[model samples]
Target: MAEISGVVERIWRYPVKSTGGERLDTVEVDGRGLAGDRLYAVRDGSGRLGSGKNTRRFRRMDGLLRLGSRLGPRLGAPQLLDPLGSPVEDADAFLRAYLEREDVALAREDAVPHFDQLPVSVLTTATLDWVRAAVPAAVVDERRFRPNILLRTPAGTPPFVEDTWFGREGRVRGGVRLAFVRSSERCAMTGLAQPGLPHAPEILRAITLAHDGRLDALATVARPGRLRVGDAMALA
Candidate 1:
């Protein structure tokens, strides 16, 4: 193993894809990813999944972000909440009302994975600080990037340090092994306004101009274990 590159700063899990997620202090990890992350997603009429960008399998339904979801009973069934922070009586109806789309419904992942790319997305505080410096007026919050693991680089570390981890192996202190697959590509979702942040198109613009539209690094769990906040990450 290599020297400690950083410490885990924050952990997040999105029970429902494309919606607000819940922060965690500790979580289980497996080959799939953080337990229950993006396990469910809103499916459109044509069987397209809801997301921040339009792709062959995903539709750009930004309104889905207005809703929030957390794991309910069964550990995978997500309980959708309204913008006012109240649990919705009917998830599909609530989604229809908020999104104004008649054919959308909440659904779980089937044979296909719900993640945009790799299962685990990792971001670092150093990169966030760099974005803040690049766009001083924008609210460059970590929530905007929606990373599953937020690593806090040591003081004075340069931004995008995680970039070097791609194609390498690493392990978290708690025994979770990972392979940094590739750099996560940024999309319009980073600029979309969510609960505590405002819509700032410039945020995406700055990333595009400076980083070629990529921000975080994507990884896949190589060994199943547990991860806790404050755990150290060592590249191998």
Candidate 2:
């Protein structure tokens, strides 16, 4: 059994699902999912997969949208809000919603808005270093790829620690099972300049160039029930 050692440095949860979220030292997790992670979303009215695709056209929109957890947890039911913690929902009773509009177009039938299909996205410091070395042009940072788990290695290590397993369950120190998957590709969303964070190759350009124009390699937690800082990960 191979291993990738690291400690949880930070945690982030998107209360509104797709919209941005707040950072926390620690939080609670259950079967439904992370307590505050991706609780709401801006749906496209059809009750299907949604995001800021069209909303990005609006100047006041874009990353301006955010999720707030002040209203307490609603289980799988997420409420809407501005970048700030406020209250919002589907006026039309749809899955997706607009940043500024109360009632927007929604998917015709019943579906749901959510983060990427995976339950949790994990990034490691070692991998970031590899990216920096491969593509010096890209100020490779975590913000570009919003990962739920940020694993910090022992300062110097190889790249893609999670790759130890092509496709298998990794037993994190805390005994959590993370079914490693193929690397996650980059997109325009990565290029979006963060609010206060410095700029970087949010586009998958750096990742692509580094991996032969292939934006692959990202770790995800499968049964994220017992993940915590200081959890050492190993291929199961």
Candidate 3:
């Protein structure tokens, strides 16, 4: 029998890399990840991936974090939205203006997945609460971490419990199974300001000094299926 550890609280999917993602009531998981997650990314003129973490080309650019991407009615087509939720007709142009770079272009991921670490990442509310307690004044919304699934663990559960999930197999209510691969490493991107959230460098520093620079768990899809908010999660 599997132990019930938590329930799905939210589902998020990033249509474009390094951009604000959409909050979904439900999402489909596959080998790569959530259906349209990280399908597209902004690339530099030299063909390097434009990532907030890739300081070389992006120069630690945080503007990408302010942009959001949503899937249009048609599949595989993502519409770019600004921080204020306004649609951008020419996404590349708007991104160029926002980043103040002329060499950047929006491009789709080919062959391999565009995820920085694993296909799927999960974080628990306990960890968020713990981090918030560490830095009381800082905003610690899960958006800063950009996880695909946010699980609400039972009350009084310890923080960073996801770390212990490594090597364990878990099943969602819809029969979707996942194998926790490893603890997700923290990056500078977490310190960048996004939309209404103010920049909080202390959050990353606390994670580094106390949590070993990791806060969440990365997982691989063992069984492709749909997952919805409020779904029960069981681990064996």
Give the alpha carbon lDDT tens digit for every residue of 23-65 in model 2.
7665555544556566544444344334534433221235433
**TM-score of each prediction:** 0.96, 0.69, 0.95
Residue pairs with backbone atoms closer than 3 Å in model 1 (clashes): none
Candidate 3 global TM-score: 0.95
* Alpha-carbon RMSD to native, per candidate: 1.2, 5.3, 1.5
List ranges where model 3 is wrong by over 4 Å.
55-59
lDDT per prediction? 0.88, 0.55, 0.87
Q: Rank the candidates by TM-score, best first.
A: 1, 3, 2
The positional error of residue 104 in candidate 2, measured at the CA in angstroms, is 3.7
Between candidates 1 and 3, which one is better according to lDDT?
1
Error of 1 at 9 (Å): 1.0
